[model samples]
Target: MRLPLTSRRSHHRSVCVLLSALLCSGLACAQASYRIATEGTYRPWSFKDAQGALQGWDVDIANALCERMKARCEILAQDWDGIIPGLMARKYDMIVASMAITEQRRQRVDFSDKYKDTISRFVAQKGTRQDVSPSALKGKTIGVQRGSIQANYLSQNYKNSDLKFYDTPQAAELDLVAGRVEYILGNMVTYYVGFMKTAESANFAFVGPDLKGGLLGDGNGIAVRKGDVELLSKINAALAAIRADGTYDRITAKYFPFKLM
Candidate 1:
């Protein structure tokens, strides 16, 4: 049954009040609960399984951190582009969507210490000889996820390449597989686990050395809104606790063949 309009407004206010006490307050606040937001489409990090249940390294790590903090936690799916705005609007408490910790992003929101470090690499169809250098890849089409550090990297390093930006990395992968683009730039671990492990990717392989530094950022971390110092500190501590107790290792093993932390 639907509630009266007044009742609905009251409920909304109550939710915000509760969240403010916990999310925007000092760690000593009484409310011990929070909601974590994820893109829920990044494979091996935070994606739904065949059963439609959310399952991935990021989900597990968020859950583990919540446990260590003795807090009530809910992992919610959100669009990648709006994740940060949602956090700022109090729609969620934190972001655990394999977002990199970068200086540009830091201006908008704070981030916890890195939970995993992955390198950006180039992938292309096998038997294609190409160099990632600007002059060599000139006129060659490249696919990259919009708003990602990889896109920034491509812009800075390969200005001569024709760049196609997709909202999701998966879209870029689809374009790469369909021969729409000669190359794709993204995290090495993501491509390996999400595509390269599959039979369809048999013909595709790494085309150049892994790219790092300058624009790619440090690594993936839990993101919270700026000025939310108390909540951020607690999350950082919880992240450390999970790693110390081996929970982080277990989650990484489930999705990746190599260590990310």
Candidate 2:
């Protein structure tokens, strides 16, 4: 049955409008949702709790940033060793783990401006009588996390010293407390919040000068794909807003006695 020419034209217009609406909806969904990857083992940064849910300073900060950006965020756990590779493979839109912004890493992925700065220090038993000076630790074994800037720094600067690499700082700390290693190198903030707070670490003391820049990189920042300038800009804006309104300071204070941002 042939329809009138006017009727056919009107029907075609309606179909076109429906298709446009569907496409627009799909695009909006895509823009509103993104995935962020984190290493679930790093305590006080991003780690799973006894309830089996992710919790930490970075987790909270990421949630706040997503809220400010008005975007839906799905936090995924990934191994620390493969984090950068996973981002390059498009497994996640961003890395909110405590990633140091070093030039070597910058070559592989872009990083947002540092939202936090932490000093690296060496820790040992309180009464161990161990001198933490670079010269004093010369032949002693030092433990550091594998694939970490701390490992790079120790290798570069302490060539003559014996180096032991662990998969995580927790492992290295365990070894240090067990007397397997002379000392452990890691962020002072992590040690203070996670390790030093424990009764077992009552005999531990942080030593050495504050480690920064050089192999340690500028500071801790979020990592995104190299061409994700738009997403990076959004995150930076959110971070700036949090800092300007003192939200960042409040978060920092919860974890430490002093401000880190």
Model 1: lDDT equals 0.87
Model 1 misplaced stretches (Cα beyond 4 Å): 1-31
Clashes of each: 0, 0
TM-score, every prediction: 0.86, 0.86
> Which sections of candidate 2 miss by over 4 Å?
1-31, 127-133
lDDT (tens digit, per residue) of candidate 2 on 1-261: 988999999999999999888978756646478899989999888899898899887888898889889999999888888999999999999999989999999999999989888679889877755466668888989999998889999988888789999989999988888889988998888998888888878788987677888789899899999999999999999999988898788877776687776
For model 1, name the residue pairs that clash. Answer: none
lDDT of 2 at 75: 93
Q: Using TM-score as the measure, which candidate wins? A: 2
81-137: candidate 1 lDDT, tens digit per residue: 788899999999999898988888999999998888869888999987756777879
**What are the RMSDs of all candidates, in order?**
10.1, 4.3
Clashing pairs in 2: none
Report lDDT (Cα) of residue 124, candidate 2.
Answer: 84
